[model samples]
Target chain A: MTPRLTAFNVVSLTLGFAFLYLPIVLLVVFSFNESKLVTVWGGFSTRWYAALLGNGPLLEAAWVSLRIGVLSATFATVLGTLAAVALVRFGRFAGRTLLTGMVYAPLVMPEVITGLSLLLLFVALDVDRGFWTVTLAHVSFSMCFVTVVVQSRLVTMDRSLEEAAMDLGATPLATFFQVTLPLIAPAVAAGWMLAFTLSLDDLVIASFTSGPGATTLPMRIYGQVRLGVSPEINAACTIMIGVVTLAILAFSIASKRGLAEPGRAEGA
Target chain B: MAEPPGRPAPLIRFEGVTKSFGAARAVAGVDLDIAQGEFFCLLGPSGCGKTTLMRTLAGFETPDSGRILLDGADLAGVPAHRRPVNMMFQSYALFPHMSVEANIAFGLRQDGVPRAEIAERVAAIVRTVQIQGLEKRRPHQLSGGQKQRVALARALVKRPLVLLLDEPLAALDRKLREDTRFELKELQARLGLTFLMVTHDQDEAMAMADRIGVMEKGRLVQVGAPAEVYETPATRGVAAFVGDSTLIEGVAGAFDGAAARLRVRAALGASSPEFVVAAREAPAEGSAVTLALRPEKLRLWTEPPEAGTPNVLEAEVWDLGYLGDKTLVRLRLPGGGTVRVSRLNASRRPEAGLSAHQRAWIGFDPADAVLLTR
Candidate 1:
């Protein structure tokens, strides 16, 4: 049975969407403003976007952030997938509860505390905190998110496929590589994308771990905001939002068309 | 069924094979011999250890005790991957991501067979299974029957010494299941491969198997030809599990080798308190025993059989169902229980001249009933 769309539902839906998207819409609109003042609409122009292209420090920081996102997401995907497999397929083992807790604790832990503890650990280890440290921090927290996404997929996977592979004369390692890995590849890809986005969006953790020559896009944006707000900042935010949105849409369409059936994922 | 000429020696043997999971025994000491080229079915209810036994043979489960022998070679340390047995899982377990051809070729590829040979064999098996044009389709695109054939093809392409089928027809619809039952039997015979199938459907086992092993609670209770198991069950549990049987509890009275008598209280009316049950062998006098009789073997009469009727009881029709080909009549006996008698509708009229609440006489031959001392 289809539910009736009442007036209250329509009103509530409209209000909820407006509350969620109004700030982003205003920022996108103001990014095209001709005036130096961000709030005032002084006719549409692309001068702020042009000025953003010439900003070397902000561009360099963005490049650094992109590299970090890609590297950390790759590492996190591997680690998280292993953790998920161990949790779901290993049945019962020693320290399983502790390992599961560690895998998920970062998801709910306060960012400041995670960042502080990571920084303190790096200090105690006498390790230099720089781009590598920032990547490590991103991997640590985003790995938890990846673990959650992949674990849910692994839990519902039909174990019979693995058994069928083994019964067909594939060894355990071969069966895992040929059957189980390919079956869960889509979820792993999704988790990687999620980790990438999380790393790109992080500011607090990056701030704690970053050292000289390791300023990320978020740090640069924050520094600019501290000096004074500009249309250039709004333009940069709009570009970041656009890139992330485009990435998500492309990922979804690619995934959906690659395998029409939700029950199975074919490796490309 | 006649044994195929030159029946090969036993292909698989289970000697005191027992497997347990922590505290519960999944497969108790099961000793069975399945000869080469024979189709054997393990029939049982759910969780009766039939699947577990099949799994052990397929090397998915290691027996806690006892040795599983294949062609006189003991299989103790061999894993499933190395076993010369292929299983068609009940769920089909087709790699959903792969095409039908890839799924069929997977076993050969895993064995490192040449690509040309693998393709040639896969093509031949697909054609043999009559799934020619479906090679390019994924499992999700195929119907239930088609998926079943794909699973069959995949298992058969390996050309293992024995093929294990776990409820092979279970996922198909009733009509499809009946059709595939015959097809699977024909395929097994044509390929000359020993087939060990596990199923709970008695009709499937009866229609396809040369021998059926009935399992109950992790134990092989009875093993025989389908006709033998159906006609003469060894125990009360096997009788009830194998088919619809009406068990009458009674006390043994007369003792003889050819025939014995049991004093059973009739189930329907209050008039007859004592009834005589003819059995092949007598239990000790005054000992409790049960009499098992099949429904189709029973004959119902309007008034009563002549005084010479051996196992006759006066009963009242309790309920009736017209099943197109046959009419099922439930009768209430003298001692307060119900027995179902199915009669073929061999006449033009649908009714069997019997209605509910009508007084009738239900009787069977003395040899039709079996005495159960359990």
Candidate 2:
């Protein structure tokens, strides 16, 4: 009976996995088809993927998105990490709960609302809403997500490590750079990756906030998909899938190496 | 190790320091003087100001009143990082992300020490703590004992003026804690640093500290060598906390030199010695007092022993526990409360004496009991 239950569980899990993955599988498989229609599966061809590389404007937009993602991710990581540390490590303060709520509130708020508010704020402040505006929007929203991720890791962190560093002649600032920051590096990296993904996939915020000459890859894709269904968008999506998969793999491998490398908790 | 570097005063001193959390005073006006190279322990029950004192020393909490002096420097405003002290957290608190080498070198690097010097010091401290060959491994790969050793190494690597340990052995198992107590004592001696350890466990404090400070209700009740604290606790709190003891409170009616007479009336007073053992500096006659006797000092027998034994009380044997080397007998005294008496199992007599519902007599020498005056 136990074996039967185990077999049943495994079968259910397999079906569940297939249900979630089947669409993505079909998308990848159809990307190679020579047919013009998305539903038809024709003979395989590398023409679309090849076309993806040669599309000058598409590649340029992708480059713009990547640059924005990298910059926003870095900025968000620093700000979010500091906010997380302040929430978790520092002593009790009167505004602590309110501050933490504000940091994490954006994670669940409507993206359209954030975009609209940000647009209004920028206009009121007389700041141009363009590539930099979109970048700022991504950073603003991503900061909260990054803060949540890092805060979860920080909450589980042993405060004694920081105290140990403090006791060993390291100031609070020094402890952050030496013990606390190094210890939470993997979480920080993970947060950055999450921030980058959020920025890369962003559309609503960018659309609401961006001006001319600030077309990101998502914005470009949105324009193409709006005009009509095309193989080019599918090709672009396939390339993204490859890049994200490779990134996740690289990150996972590096993190596992770091985990295996430390035999003991040392300072921070 | 080797006591780090010293100035010309006690490594750390608490001068009438008090710490309050909201409405509760966790540490109340504690005055302490810790000598250089002293393995001092602040011991008490939970929430009894021992950890509070340690925290004040480690700069985790600033005292609400009075000052802290470290090596003759007024440290009232000195933060934990600026203080010439380090603390090994009870959780080990090893950095989970960095390699052991990086963790050990973290403080040194933060202090702007050359990378070579940090490496050298890390290696030296790690070697001293015997955590070699595991410098490249993350904390998850290490065992609990190994983690504790690494923590010790980290705290000592920088050679702080004082090393604070907050219940360092509270996380370990019983057998492991017992074994590590000796190791910790040996480590403190070898390092010769002023070690201030906070623990709720009396045995751990007694085993590890050259001097033990007993705290109760946010007050430092007594500070002395382990034997001094154990043999003659200054208060009922210390007596009951530092070790298992039978306490009997009564008013003293008469006193004569080393012996005293009391108007006995507490629970288990009937089972107490016929007379109280007065200390050299006991309170005035007719004052209320408490008498305490350790379990190891009391002897229990199946039947009343010989005459002229001085102190004897009839009791009903209720429970029994046989430790390999000793036997603990719980006797329900006729005076209402129960008392435990531990006897060494030198021979097979304990087996013969061990029986429930048996009548027994508990006796101890007058010198074995003490009058607590706190």
Worst 10 residues of 2 chain B by lDDT: B258-267
Each prediction's fraction of true contacts recovered: 0.59, 0.68
The C-alpha RMSD in Å for every predicted model, in order, reads 3.6, 4.7
State each candidate's clash count. 10, 8
- Report the lDDT tens digits of candidate 2 across residue range B200-227: 8888888889999899999999999999
Query: Candidate 1, residues B1-374: lDDT per residue as tens digits?
Result: 23368865578989899999889998999999899888999999999999999999888888999989898788899999999999998888899878999999999999999999998999999899999999999888888899889999999999999999999998889998898999999998888999999999999999999999999999998999999999889889999989899987766666545445555543333453455666655567778777788989988899878888777788889999888898889998766888989998888786856889999998887668777787
Q: In candidate 2 chain A, where is summed lDDT lowest over 10 consecutive residues?
A: A259-268
DockQ-based CAPRI category assigned to the predicted complex of candidate 1: acceptable
Q: What lDDT does the true structure give each of the candidates?
A: 0.88, 0.81
Best-matching candidate per lDDT? 1
- How much is A157 displaced in model 2, in angstroms? 1.1
